[model samples]
Target chain A: MDFKELDPILHSQLRLAVVSLLISVREAEFTFLKEKTNSTAGNLSVQINKLKDAGYIEVTKQFSKNYPQTICKITKKGIESFEDYVKALQSYMNPGGN
Target chain B: MQPVYCFINRLFKPKFQSMQSENFSPKDSLLLIDSMINQAKNRFTENGFLYLLWGWLIFISAVSHFILLKTRLLKHPEMIWMSCWVAIIFQIIYLVRKNKKEKVKTYSDGIIDNIWMCFGICMMVLIIIVSRNNLWIYMYPFTLMIYGIPTFLSGVTMQFTPLKIGGISCWALAILSTITLPIYYLLLLAAAVLIAWIIPGYLLRKKFKNQH
Candidate 1:
């Protein structure tokens, strides 16, 4: 049994989905992430904060069309962790390395 | 309820029905990442607009130039190139409008934008070279070759095959044009634009619509 431990921050369902979407685009509006992840605004906001606190993502607050806009972008560290997290999952999925 | 809030809720409501129904498994995480990445990579809507615009402009200009020369209908047939200047202005407007409408800037979008900007600069320099050195006879083939550089790279970035194929055809035609008489090179360029820009542009548009 040579299973690898997953990153605790990315192990949850909603958090994992948010990071998954962010990994692809590197940056996305908060609404885009919310829509893609299918998470409630409150829940998505909380997960985004967790990712930011972990230094895995950066959150930008700006104004667009006189409305407050929140944009979330993945940092270098986020990419590294996402890659490692995927690798860990891969090993777990195929422990025999086949 | 506010209209904006209602709109947001309507947009998000459908997604809620299908989510969080399963446990947070590592396999699910892997699947999510794969799907999300594919979604990001397949954007083609804006590409179509750019390709079709430039393609038609160049194609019409080149074909008409060839015709005017062949018929000897105009004393200043070279003036047809002014259309390209008009197209360039429209292209600027298109870019600025796109910039205003674009909300999220992807890494790939930024790279593609820079590639086209560099291509524009090269064309200006080529124009100067031709006007100053009187190398108009040799210019079309060289210009076609230059066009291929960005076209090929755009294909790679968009992961679109038609653009790559289009780019190759431009270079091949350029080589052929170099050996042939310069008079026939305008026709070759018209052919080049049809392949390198118009076809790929429409294909890009189709892909974009399908994705949306």
Candidate 2:
């Protein structure tokens, strides 16, 4: 897949932030992502839904300690896309994939 | 006993709630929370470093055993076992270091992982220095299986396919090693442990370090 084509999705800072955090953690609760991104619940939820629609992440809703919890996990496709996005970004920055 | 109260009441909530929202923005709250998390992460990193040190202590001891195997000291198997105990002492120190770093203590998989590795180390050492009969041969496969279980679990917990694959490979090799116990099985056992545990241990240590 040509990652340059994914520039629009990858260019959004909030979406990029979501992917980066997910990469490290493998999975995170919605509250955790909300706090980390420092974005409003509405905005964060919207972006997460977008990523989910894109097949980049899977959202699982569950209960923890009687509290509703939403968990997000990046898929293999997401990982591949993120790597490609990183390469594209690097090329844009350095004019070389290196 | 109530550490939460100490943090909320004694530390910040009084001054925080007293101040006007105009004076203190949510950005300030974010900064405070970030600092708190950073400190927590630093503590975790230190604990991970201590764990890595424990693994390294065992690695060094194993290497020492290799060297000692060739020398006249080979005659003194009890002395070598004593040295392994010394390594165990260092491992205890590592455990202490890890325990001190984490406050909200519960037995997580990391504790289980270390405990399993410790068992494997002890059994492997006994097989080398004490057990002379054919029954000792089982220790080779047993240690391999013990070492692989935690590795596999950690991989599943973290959702990493490569690590999961590595763990399965160790299990498969352990079985194969058990079956293929021909001449020089001791050397083969060493090679298997190194591949199964040591290499993955190093990779895990490195991965844990980077995650921090």
**Tens digits of lDDT, candidate 2, B68-159:** 66554776532543665776687787666554432222223455556557756676676766366656556556656665676566556545
lDDT of 1 by residue, B27-58 (tens): 66778777777666554435589789889988
Candidate 2 chain B weakest lDDT stretch, 10 residues? B18-27
Q: Candidate 1: which stretches are off by over 4 Å?
A: A1-5, A90-98, B1-23
DockQ (C-alpha based) per candidate is 0.27, 0.02
lDDT of 2 by residue, A1-98 (tens): 11233244443556667776676553567876777668889978988998999898999886644767788888898888888866554443343344
Please list the residue runs of candidate 2 whose C-alpha ends up more than 4 Å from where it truly belongs after superposition: A1-98, B1-73, B76-81, B103-134, B160-163
Candidate 2 global CA lDDT score: 0.56
Ten-residue region with minimum lDDT total, candidate 1 chain B = B1-10
Cα error, candidate 2, residue B184 (Å): 3.2
lDDT of 2 at B26: 25
> What would the per-residue lDDT of candidate 1 be over residues A1-98, giving only the tens digit for each residue?
45566676776677777777777774788887777767799989988998999999999997766778888898899889988888887876776776
TM-score of each: 0.82, 0.43
